[model samples]
Target: MATPYPTPISLSKTCIGWTDIGLMGSPMASHLLSVGHSFSIYARDPSKALQLQSKGVCLINSQQDLAKISDIFFTIISGPPDVCSIILGPQGVLSSLNPGGVIVDMTRNHPALAREIFKPARKKDSWSIDAPVSSIDVGAREGRLAILAGGDIIQWLSPLFRIMGKHMYVGEAGCGQSCKIGNQIVGSANPLGLSEALTFAERAGLDLKKVLEGIRRGSAGNMIMELFGPGGFAESLVKDLGMGLDLLESEEERAVALPGASLCKQLLCGMIANGDEKLGLQGLVTVIERINDIQK
Candidate 1:
C-alpha cells in the first residue's frame, strides 16, 4: 500500500525517535525533551539507551518500533553504513513509520544516500529531513548546535529544529551534507594556517607568547589557537586527544586534491599531515629543514 502524496503538509502531532543517543544526539534529544517533545530512542549499545532512559526519554526495543510510533524520525549514527542499516535495512524505520511522519537524519554522511532515503519514506508518504548537526559534544550539550535541514518539510521541522538548536535551512536533502563537508575543508586548514603564522613569528626571533598577545588583539587571532592552547601547534595534542592518524593522512590528501589551496601549501600540508598532527602545524618546521637539507 502506498501512502498518499503530501503537498508539503505540516505536522503538529509529533513523536520523535533518535537512532543513536551518544555525543551530539544525547544532548540534542535532551533539548527536545526540555521543550516538551516526547521522543523514543534506539542505540546499538543498550547502555546508551539506558542513559537516555535515565534522562526520561522513552526507549524502544527496535528501529522499526521507533518509526511505527514516532511522527518524526532522526538518526545520528557515525557514518554511511549505519544510516543504511537503520533506514533502508529490512527492519528499517521506513517500514514502521506511520503515514505523514517526518524522518530526520542528524549524521554527517554521504549526501546521495540521504536523498535516496527520501524515496521510500515518500512512498509511505513520510518525509525525510537531512539535518546533520554542526558542533562538538560540548556544543550539543549547550543546545547551541547549528542544524542544517533539507527537504520541503520545513514547516513540520522548523519548530522542532528551533527547540533542538540554532539552525539554518541549507537547501533540500544533500544540501546539509554538502555544507558539512565544506565546513570540514575550512576546519582542516585552521590549525595549519595558525602553525605557519606562528612559525613565521618565531623565525623572526619574535617571542611567540608576546606575538600571540598582539595577534590575539588583531585579525591574526583565531579559534585554532584556543583549541591548541598556549603551546600553539605542538605534537602533544595528537597523543593526548587520540585524533586519528588516518584523518591526518586524509588531510594531506584533501589539501593536494582539493581546489584552491596553493600547490606549495598543499605539499607542505601533505608533509605535515603525513608526519603528525599532535606536533601542531609547527611540525612543518621540520619538513622545511628537511627540504633545505636535501638541497644542500
Candidate 2:
C-alpha cells in the first residue's frame, strides 16, 4: 500500500537532514552543503559534525527534531537493527515525518528490512527509498560513489542523487538492497581470484609487483585489482558477503547458486580465524599464503 511521494519544488526549497557522520557520510553531507541546500544533520557524537556545523548546517539533537524540519531525511547507519530503531522507534524520524516527507536509507541493507520500512512510511503519507551506495575512500571524498536507488521516486530524487554520485533507480523499495547484495556477491570473485593468482606467482618465485603490473594491462585488469593491488582492509566485505549468503539461505526455494561467493566467504572466514579480519581484501593473499605454507 505504498504510494508515490510528490516531488518537491527545487533543491533550494527542499529541506534536507541526515544521520551518520562517519567517514562516508561526512563527505556526502559536505557535497549537499556545497550546493547551498537548507540542510540539518544529526549525529550521536556532535563533535564529529562540528566542521559541518561551522559551515552553517544545523546540527540537530535527534531524529525526531530532524523529521520535524526535513522534507527529505537520509540515513546511512551501521546495520539493519540501528536503521529500524532510528526510523521505527518511539523517537525515530518517521514518527514525526511531515506529510509528503521521504526517507532515503543509504545503508547496505537487507531487502526485507527495506521493504518493511516502505510500509510505515507510506502509512504516514510519506515515502521511502533504499539507496545503498558503494565507494572507496577516495571516491567518497570525490563524490564519485555509485548509488543504486530503489523506489518509484527516482525522477523526483535525481537532482539530489546527482550531488552524491552516479545513481540508477533499479526498482521498488527493496530492490536497491537486493542489487547491492548481488553486486557484493559478484565482486567477491575479484579479490578471491586475485589472491589465488598472486599466491601462484609468489610460489613460482615470480616478482609479486611485476605480476600485478602485468595484470593491470591485460583482460584481467579490474577496478578491484587497481584499488586493492597492494592490499587494503576489506573488513566490510565480511559483512557484505555474509548478508548475501544469508539472503540466499533465506530464499532456498529459488535454487540460485553462487559457488564463487561461497568459496570467498570460506576464505574470509579463514582470514577471520587467523585474527586478520582487520586486513583488506588484499589480505586474502595472506590467507592464500598460509594455505600454501609459503614463508614470509
Candidate 3:
C-alpha cells in the first residue's frame, strides 16, 4: 500500500489558518492533515507553531499570505479582537484575498461581527461563514467534532467538516453562535456544582473519597466527577472518553457561556466570595479551609 494518509481525495483544499492550539486545535489540525488539506498558519506567538512543525505541517508566513494562496481560510482563535484583526485589519486576510475565496470562522464570534465579515468578503466575491465548533482535544483528533453552523456555505463545506465534527446544524449567520453559547452553559453545570459540593464536604470534615463515593455511582453523579474523579480516574479517562467544551472557546461565542447562565456563575461566586479574594480563582479550597478555621 502507498499510504493511508495524505491521500488524494476528490476535494482540493487550501486553508489560511490561525488557531489557539493549546488543546483542541492540535488534534483538529492533525485530523485535517491526515485528510491532506494544505494549510498555512499565522499565530500571534510563533512558538505555538512548533508542535505543528513537528507533525510535518506547512507554515504560512502571514494572514495576508494565507489569503493570497488559500481558497478557504479557517481560524480557531481565542477572542474577538484576534478574530477581527485576522479578517479585517491591515495585515488581515481580508486585505489580500482573491475573488471567490471564503472564510470559515470556526471560532464563535459576536453575531453582529460575523455579519460584518460577510459584508466585505461578499463584495469581493469572497464569503465568510460563522460555523462555530464544539469539542475537546480528544474529539478533534478523532474527527468527531460537533459543529453549529450559520449560513448557506455550510452545504459547500459539509463534506470537509465531516472530517472535523459531527453535524449540529442550527441555522444561519448567528444561530450557530447562539447554540454554541447555550452549550457552554450546559458544560459549566458540572464544574460549578463540583466547587460547591466539594466545599461542603471539606467544611464538614468528611472524607473526600467517601463523599465522592456517596454522590457518585448514584443520582448525584455527573460528567465532571466521572472524568476528574480520583479512583482510577487518570489521564486516560479524558483520553478515552471525549469532553464537549461547547463552542464557548471561541471569541464570538465566549460570552455565550456568560449570557443567561447566571446559576453556575452565581454559585461559583458565592463559594469564592465566602473566602478571601487574595487566594484568586482556582482557590476554592480556601473557602473550606477558612470555614474550618473559624469552627476550630
Candidate 4:
C-alpha cells in the first residue's frame, strides 16, 4: 500500500520534529524554539525535553507520532547506524512521514548511507537533506554552527539555516556528508598535532600555557589550539576521530591513504581502551604522554 503523505506546508509555518536531544541537538532545538517555531520532540528521557516542553514544544512518545504531523523532521543523532535505524527501520521516519515532508539529517553520517536514504525518500514524495553540521557544542549553543547542506532545497531552507548558522549548499543528496567527512579528516587531525606539540613542550619543561600563547600568535595559530588548547573539551576528539575512521572505511573502495587520520584513530582508540574516552579532546595530551613514556 502506498503511504499517504501530508500536504506540504509553508516552510515558515511547518511543524518540525526535533529528534535526538544530545549535547548539540538540545541547543539547536532551543534556538528554533526561541525563534517561535512549533516543535514536536521525541527524546528517550522526557526530563531532558522538559525545558523545550515548557516553551510550547510538544513532547511525543514515538518517532512515528512525531513524523505524523511534522512537515520537516530534523535528526542529529550520533553515528551512521543510529541515523539509518531512525530513518529506515520499521516504524521509522520513512514509514510514517507525510509525502511532502522534508527530512534533514544533520548527523555526521556516511555519504553512501545518505545517498541510499535519498532514493526511498524521493519515492515517498519527500526530500532528504544531508546537512551535517560543523563546530562544537559551544557553537551550537551560540547559534553559530557552520552547516554544509546537500539537496535541492537550499534556497527554500536558507532562512531556517540562518536561524542556526551560516550554511553552504554543497550539492545533491550526500554531498553534505562528503563535506563533513572532509571536515572530520581535518578536524580530527589537528588535535593530534596539538596533542603532540603540547606533550613535547610539557616534557621539555616549558610552561605549556606560555607555549600555547607564544605559538597562537605565530603561524601555528588555529581554532583547534585556541578553542581546545589547554582547558577545552577533549572527549570530542575521540568522537570525531572515530567518525573520521568510519568515513574512511565507507570509502575503502577508493583506496584513499590517510595516515594521519589513521594515527589519530589509533590514538583515540587507545584512549577508549585506556578508559580515558570520557575526557575532552584536550585529554589527548594524556595519550601522547603515555606514548612518550613508552618511547622513553
lDDT for model 1 comes to 0.66
Which regions of candidate 4 deviate over 4 angstroms? 1-12, 229-253, 294-296
lDDT of each: 0.66, 0.83, 0.62, 0.79
Q: Which of 1 and 3 is ahead in TM-score?
A: 1
Error of 4 at 54 (Å): 1.1
Per-residue alpha-carbon lDDT of candidate 3 for residues 1-296, written as tens digits (9 for 90 to 100): 11111222234434535455656666776677777766666656778878888777667677787667776677777656778988899888889877767777887466667777888887887777887776555667678778888765677667678888777667876676666655655555555466567777876888988888988878978665654422111121121111123334545444333442454444335454564323322343444445456342
Per-residue lDDT, model 4, residue 19, is: 86
Candidate 2 has an lDDT of 0.83
Query: Can you write out model 2's per-residue Cα lDDT over 1-296, one digit (the tens) per residue?
Result: 01224755365777888998987899999998898888899998899999999899889989999888888899988878899899888999889998788899999788888988999888878889999986665777798989999976788888888988899989988989989988887677888888899889987899989999999999999888767743324567777777777776675225467777878888888888899877767788888899899888
Please tell me which predicted candidate would have the highest lDDT against the true structure. Answer: 2
Best-to-worst TM-score order? 2, 4, 1, 3
Least accurate 10 contiguous residues by lDDT in model 3: 232-241
- The alpha-carbon deviation from the true structure for residue 49 of candidate 1, after best TM-score superposition, in angstroms, is 2.4
Tens digits of per-residue lDDT for model 4 on 76-163? 9877888889899997987898777788999977778888889999997888889999887888999999999997777767767898
| lDDT for 103 (candidate 4) | 88
